[model samples]
Every structure is written in structure tokens, then in C-alpha cells.
Target: MGMHDNSRCINCEWAVAGTGQKFCPNCGQPTPVHRIDWHFLGHELEHSVLHMDRGILYSLKQLMLRPGVLLRDYIEGRRGNQVKPLLLITMMSAAVVLLNKLVSGGSLIDGGAHQAIATGQAVPEQLQQFMLASRTVGEWISGHFAAFTLMLLPFEALTFWLVFRRFSRLNYPEWLVISTLLTVQTFVIWLLLIPLHRWLPYAQSLAGLMGMVYGAASLMQFFATRPLLSTLWRTAVALGVFSVTSTVLVLVATIVVTWRA
Candidate 1:
């Protein structure tokens, strides 16, 4: 009947807004959609359920091939095609965690060291508080494994900002985005190495080394105008500064935590 033929959306009564309006303006469902079928169900499952066609792999591939260019582009606002930095790192973090759990059945942080510090009676007098503070830090990190991993974002951003300030016109938040994608790079390296090393602790050293090398390469590309040797030394300084700063923070936090306790 004539009544069966209408320009309105089936999901919502909003009429087609324009000649080529693909989705309803009111409800946002596709206008004049296909009837349910096995093929539609399968396609929906792939697209929505698993996100089989998502930007996850594409982002990783781009990062691998051109880390500095990709990150610099992303920071400069050329980010429509790939996965966002935060999501990429978060997903990579989950992958690393899952793989660690499957292989070692152990937490990324070493709880036994903390437990030993708590239980031992002969930790010496002066070192006792220090040990306890370390234990406190370790416990928190262990308990919040995912968060602990992501916690490096800001500090890393600050570290890079300080070392590369002369070269980069980027602000603090932009550095954070750059840091996050770099973190995704690190996590991807960890994911690959952890399985071979059979656990986090064993794989961690090599993973860290590989990550630093990757960072150096990325910096070289990002600062392509600079000599490669100059970029390499700057990356080295950045890593050293990051390490020292992180150590100081942990020690200061340990003292504060123990003092308050």
C-alpha cells in the first residue's frame, strides 16, 4: 500500500533530512536499513563485538614503521584515521597484563619482597623504615597493576618536555599525548618479549632496553632536522633524567608514607 512507502526512519519517526541523509537525525540509526539476516548479524558481530575492523592494528603498524612521525602528526592534530593514544596504550596495557597473567601467574610488582620486609625481624634498625616504605610503594603498585603502568604518562611527559624543550614547541599536554603513544610502543615490546622471557620480571630489562632504543629512533625521526647523533645523546639525557627523577620521587614518597604511618 501507499502507506508502506514513507521517507521516515523505521527506528525513529524523523523524516530524511536531505537527499543523501544516511542516518536519522533524531535517533541516528541508519535510514532505510537492511532487513535482519545472517549476513547482517555476522557483519555486526565482527564490527561491534570484536571490532575486527577497528584501528588497533593499524595504529600499532604505523607506530612501528614511523613512531616519531606518527606521534608528531598525532600531536599536531592529524589523528582522524588511527586509534587514539590513550586507548591504544590502555588496550596494549591490558594485553600485556593478560599475557603476563597467562604465562607467569604473577603480578607485575613483586609482592614477596614486600612480604619479606614485613615479616623479617632482622632488617636492621636504620633500614627498617626505608624497607617498609619500599614495601608500601610495592604493595600499591602491585595491587593496582594497570594503574601503576599507566601512571608513568605524566612523569614521562614532563621528562621529555624538559629534555627536548629547545627542540619542541609542544606544551605539556601535547607531550602527554606523545608520551602515551610511546607507552603503547613500550607495551607492545613488552607483550612480545614477556612471553619469550616467561614473565615480567625476567623480560623487563630487555623490554626496557628495547623501549629506550625505540624511543631514540622515534626521537631521531621526530627531530629529523637535527643530526642523528645529536638526537641520540638528547634521548640518552632524557632517559637518565627520567630515571633519576623517578627514583627521587619514589624515595621521597617512601619517606613521606613511612613518616605518616
Candidate 2:
């Protein structure tokens, strides 16, 4: 403990006691010199304890080992030691997309452009020219896919929140938190499976299916809190809503992009 004679709160500059005082009474900040010695690694040890729980590895481990339980705890006001949902998802999605670019050296969504050209079904000259001239746009889309996900996430969360309305009266933001974490988990799966796509051929599809199952399980476990059949039906309804909403958004975006091109 810091000495009362020389001890002070770093944050509020208030005096603190030297003996048996773990924290400052005035500012609530932990005392820095808790029986410190020149050779002892107290600062490092304190940092390790305070920061280890907030690391990406800790969040990933929780997501992988007990995603439903983690979400439940987080939603039920037990968030002291857990990662923030938005930050965790953002980091996961960024890591997934960056690693994907490193491994493939191409845009993941470029397959759609390739397929359109390959069809050769009386393609319009302007459309073909636009497509050819849109490599930069495609790269931008690839790099910003995570941003797109975040933008569309509120609508996705709405689907579940609407379908499972009876289970919880919380507003959209609460559901958005759940959706973000689930989406991040999907990105994790995508990162793991993208490299295997060449050999497995259907690896991406498998990952997508796993993501859907994981999302459904999370919803059912965290929100539904009902019988298996009832929870499954609610999950199906949410998925249906998400699918229709995504399709409409994609069509609209495609039209806008093509028009602008």
C-alpha cells in the first residue's frame, strides 16, 4: 500500500492511506504502490490481472466454449469481466477479412462478377464494360464487408427481436448486441474454413450452415427459453425474416451500384 504521507490518487489527486488500503477512498482508483519493492514486478502483475480478461483470446475462448452461456450472462447484467460485444465483433470481423485477403489475394465476392461474365447470356455492352471497370469497387466491397455487416446488423437483429418478442421486452439494441456476437462467431468460422475451400470445395457453404445453426442456437438458448419445437419455430421465423430482408437489400444495392457505374 502507498504511504499516507506520500500516497495520492492518480486520477483525482486525493490523498490515500498507506496501510491496508487497496484503493483510494476519494476517487475509487486502486493504489499504485501496494507494498512495492524495486525488484518486484507489481505493475506488470497488476496489468496482467486487469487486462488479461479483456484480451481477444479471452473473448474468443468464451465464444467458442460457451457462447450461449456467455450471451446469457452478458444480457443478464453480468458483464464486468467480459468483452464489449461491438468491439469484439469488430475485431473478429476485421481479423477474418484481413486474413482472408492474405490467403486468397482476391475478393471473396468476385465470384459473382466472374459468374455473370461466364454466363455469356446476351450480356449488354454497357454492363460488360461496367463490370470490367469495377475491379476497384469489388475490392472495396471485399475490404469493407465487415462494415457492411455492421450496417445491416440492426435489421438482422430486428428479425429475431420481432419473432421472439414474447421472450424479452428489451429493445432492439439488446438484440443487436446478441446479433453482433453471433455474427463475429460466424466470421471466426469463415476465417477457419476459407483456407480449406480449395480442397473441400464446399467449405464456405459448410461454414455458412454452421453459422446459421450457431445463430439459431444462441437465439433459442438466450431468448426463447421455451420448448424445443417452439424455440426452433421462432428461430426459423427469424431466419426467414433475415433472408427476405437481406435479399431485398442486396437487390437494391446491386441496382444502385450498377446504375452508378
Candidate 3:
């Protein structure tokens, strides 16, 4: 253990006990408080302990390896060592957006319109207008990718809530949390696969499928009390609902933006 300035509670100024206490009696912060140093590199880092400024890797590991268990634990109040769900997903969204830019030259979503316009390709006046509007909408969505991702999460969360309602005791907010973590795991997958875009144009598709697999696996393990086959079909149904709803929403959004442009 690193040396701790256990004379007083740094947070609340409460007098310390006999140095064995792991948390402050007043503020409840972890004790034996040492500076964030090489001890951070030691076993003291303890990624499993949640809510006290742990690394992002720990959250990703749990999301990948035991996402259902992690979600259930967080929902049921074992949330000490985990990163905030919103914060984690936002950061992952930013990371995924940045990686997409780096590997795809930031053109993956522009649908080749950017290159066509930039190269002075011959085009009809109507087509030119449409391309410009589409490019603008695409750029805006990419720039605000985190917000865009969050906007889509509600639809998926609602689907999950409705599909799993009978088997689940979780409320809508808890389902939202589960949806966020599951969605961000796809971001984690993208971070791993996006760099391969130079050699694998299909990497994004593969990542999407992998994300689906992870989400299905998470639900299967999470609701193990339900029949496995039932869970599988329900999951598929939930995803189908999310897909149709989100697609309509996106199409409407694109139309609005395109019209305004």
C-alpha cells in the first residue's frame, strides 16, 4: 500500500480512525488516500471497484466479457467501480467518430458526393443540389455523432423495454442504461476494427454484426431465467422494432434537413 495521509479526511476534515478503515466515515471516499502515482500501476488500481475514477478499459472489459452481469449489478446497486454510463458512451462515441475519420478519410458517410463535387464532376443542377444537402446532413451527423447516437438509443431502449417487459423487473431508465452500454460496446468494437478499413472496406459491417452478437449474448446471459429460445426470439423482435423505428426517424430527419438545405 502506498503511504497515505490518513491524519484527516481530505474531503470532509473528519478525524481518521486507526488507519485500517477503507472509506471515510463522513464522505465515504476511499481511504489510505495516496497520490495518483506508480501505485496506480500496481494491483491497487483494482479495476473491479467501481465509481471511484477507474479507467475506461475496465468498463470496456466488463461490457465485453460480462455485460449482462455488469448491467444487472449496476441496476441492482453494485455501481461503485464502474464509469458513469453516459460518460462512457459519450467518450466511446467520440473515439469511434475520431477513428472513423482517421481510417475512412472522413468520407465514408458523404456517399462519394464530396469527391464528386470537389473534382468538378458533371452533374445535373437538381442532382448537384441534392448531393450538397446530403453531404451537409452527413457532415452534421458525423460532427455531432455522440448526440446522434444518444438520440437513437431511446428507440432501442423502448424496444428492449417492451420486448422484455414480462421477463424483466427493470424500469425504462434501467433499460436505457442497458441500451447505452450495449450500444457503446459496438463503439468499442469499431475502435478495434475501424483501423482495418484500409484493407477491409467491410470492417464496419462486420463490426455491426459483432455488436449485434454481443448485444444478443448480453441479453441471453442477463435474462437467463427466461427460456433461452424465448430470449433469442424476443431479442430478435426487439432489434427488428428498433430498426424500423430508427430508420423511419432517420429518414424523417434527413428529409427535414435536406429540405431546409
CA deviation > 4 Å runs, candidate 2: 1-6, 19-23, 28-30, 33-55, 115-122, 126-137, 200-205, 223-225
Better candidate number, 1 or 3, judged by lDDT: 3
lDDT of 3 by residue, 169-243 (tens): 788899899999999888888889888877766665677778888899998988878799998998889877887
Task: Show how many residue pairs clash in every candidate, following the order shown.
Answer: 0, 2, 6
C-alpha positional error of residue 234 in candidate 3 after TM-score superposition, expressed in Å: 2.0
Error of 2 at 260 (Å): 2.0
TM-scores, all models, native as reference: 0.76, 0.78, 0.77
- Order of models, best lDDT first: 3, 1, 2
lDDT of 3 at 250: 61
C-alpha RMSD for every candidate? 4.7, 4.9, 4.4
Q: Could you give me the TM-score of model 1 versus the true structure?
A: 0.76
Candidate 2 lDDT at 255 equals 59
